[model samples]
Target: MNLSLCMIVKNEAATLHKCLSSVANVVDEMVILDTGSSDRTPEIAKSYGAKVHHFRWNNNFSTARNEALKYVKGNWVLVLDADETLTPEIVPQIYSVIQREEYLLINLLRQEVGAEQSPYSLVSRLFRRHPEIQFSRPYHALIDDSVATILAKEPKWQIGYLQGVAILHKGYQKSAIAQGNKYAKAQAAMEQFLAAHPYDAYVCSKLGALYVTTGKINEGIELLKRGVRTSEENYEILYELHYHLGIAYSRLQNPKQASLHYQAAIKLPIYPILKLGAYNNIGNLLKEAGDLKTARKAYEAALKIDDNFAAGHYNLGMTLKAMGLFTDAIACYQKAIKLNPRYAEAYQNLGVVQLKVGNHQASLIAFKNAIALHQEQNPEEAQRLRQGLQEMGLL
Candidate 1:
């Protein structure tokens, strides 16, 4: 049950220590392969007692990752990123699975953190270190290709998804400039890879996402739409494609098309965040269309699926408030606050509802809370709140 921690890192000085510290005690050995880091990344890895290897910056992620794999002497390897860390719960789960000889591949859930976070099921953060499990492609490298081959031919190796471990991904932290640069490099590599493998739907879909992130809206939408058309059977890509299309259309103010795509997105087995987002968007569109009842229904449906869904609650409250259902709206806003106490939009909505219902003192408190939260996240929003309060003579 020897577990080796394998990682690929670059200029990750800020987050490298936290990532290493999270899983330092869990693995038998730590192997870090640096792709020409110019920062204190390698030094941090060494400080954490990780055996560091410097590799030339190759555009292909799989190549560097496979090279890191070569240094892993343990029976099982846990692949991680410099921006990711394993949770304490996942450590014991990997150990338990490694104690058994039946399982060859185990998939863990990767939860991306921060304000705009989402979760996805990912494989091979933990798996057997067999020579047959070679990674593939440039970006978003996967070991599943070889594992699938083994499963197809041998039919003896066990493949299962483990709920015990979750990878906390912090790649999208507040450092927008650094994150954008990483994406720029990835986009360049992906473009070169796509030139050789043009029909790769996964790569195309990722490229679309990158374009959308970089504000190339029309190009991103077109790429995503093409990806969906080519891989119609691939529900996963279709889900993402439809979701992003809705986003692009919404930005264009084409509510009709946005609603259609949003509806299509929810039909696929995507993550909860996507599902909730679709629901929220649909509700918003319906509200804008003057279909208040349907909007309420959509929001309620989202809440039924995930009670702690803060956006759903906030949107529902907004809809209810617009319809003059002040008490019900307040309840929804309160529920949103319970789920996410730091939700500034919910507090603002709650304040507005309270003011409408003549609860000036409670409204003032809610407005102040909203202002405090918004000041940290968005000063412009805080200014708007202050303006509203001043207009009401509450400031």
Candidate 2:
């Protein structure tokens, strides 16, 4: 059972070596399609024994990926990117996976690495070489339709999930986006895709997300709403549309509409992290609306899903403090601190709650700890803490 590694890259010279080196010893063959790189990327890949081929950029990921498929010599294909590296610990198990006859495709968990907030997403990148199994969707190219087509033709075809196999992706970070013209290119590609696929709910949702990220709140809200109405059958897109719509409305200061969309997102069978975000944001909006009881319930709902979620604990603490429940608020804050020792905001809030309960010494200590943590990283916040301490006659 031979596994061929396929990748399409352009101007990824900086991190290409790390990516290629990570999987060079594992795969049977490496086939890289370079989309006009003006760097040493091709040479670096070739140095690692990759059969590098030059391809013209067409603003379509599926196009390049399909072209690369023609060069794969192995029976099984593992599609990856120049910014991603497979986990070294699971490299040995990949060979056995390629030999499995029951499944037509295998799904791996791709985890974002070196980002402030890393999230894991299931992606179908490993599969048997078949002419019918190709990539689709312009901006965020996917093989869902192709996979469905293959499975329809072969009734016994199955998709298996590899639990331990994972890839670390660094290309999706803000710093990486700013390093190249990638964001601009992606925005343009999304707009182009939307023009051709006007009624495509998935494209609309993706474009709407890009608009939100680029700060076009009104436009994002309109597109997201369209996506929601057009994508009733697509639960994935509907979840995203409602979640992003809630965020856009929150930005517009329309808490009522925001809460409605957030609640809608929460009801969807989406990822737990996304559901947690919806619950937390809904709690924030309700708290701002002076609905302390409901806000507390929302926070509790978030915590029930993950008790170690420090943000949920901190948010509940804030709501409790606003309701004049100082002791309970302090307890929540302490739990947040226990979950995350470096939570400066949690410590600051704890100090405030402690001061309210007439524990000046403990309050001063908490404030000092908070100040020490934020002094260099957040000078403004540290100064504000100092002023708070002076007012309390503790400094």
- Give lDDT per model, in order: 0.81, 0.84
Off by over 4 Å in 1: 99-102, 115-124, 177-180, 269-274, 338-341
Model 1 scores a C-alpha lDDT of 0.81
> Per-residue CA lDDT of candidate 2, range 316-376, in tens?
9999999999999999999999977888999999998998899988998899989988896
Q: Candidate 1 — worst ten consecutive residues by lDDT sum?
A: 114-123
| Candidate topping TM-score | 1
Q: Compared with the true structure, what per-residue lDDT tens digits does model 1 show for residues 173-223?
A: 667437557787879888888889776677778888778777888888888
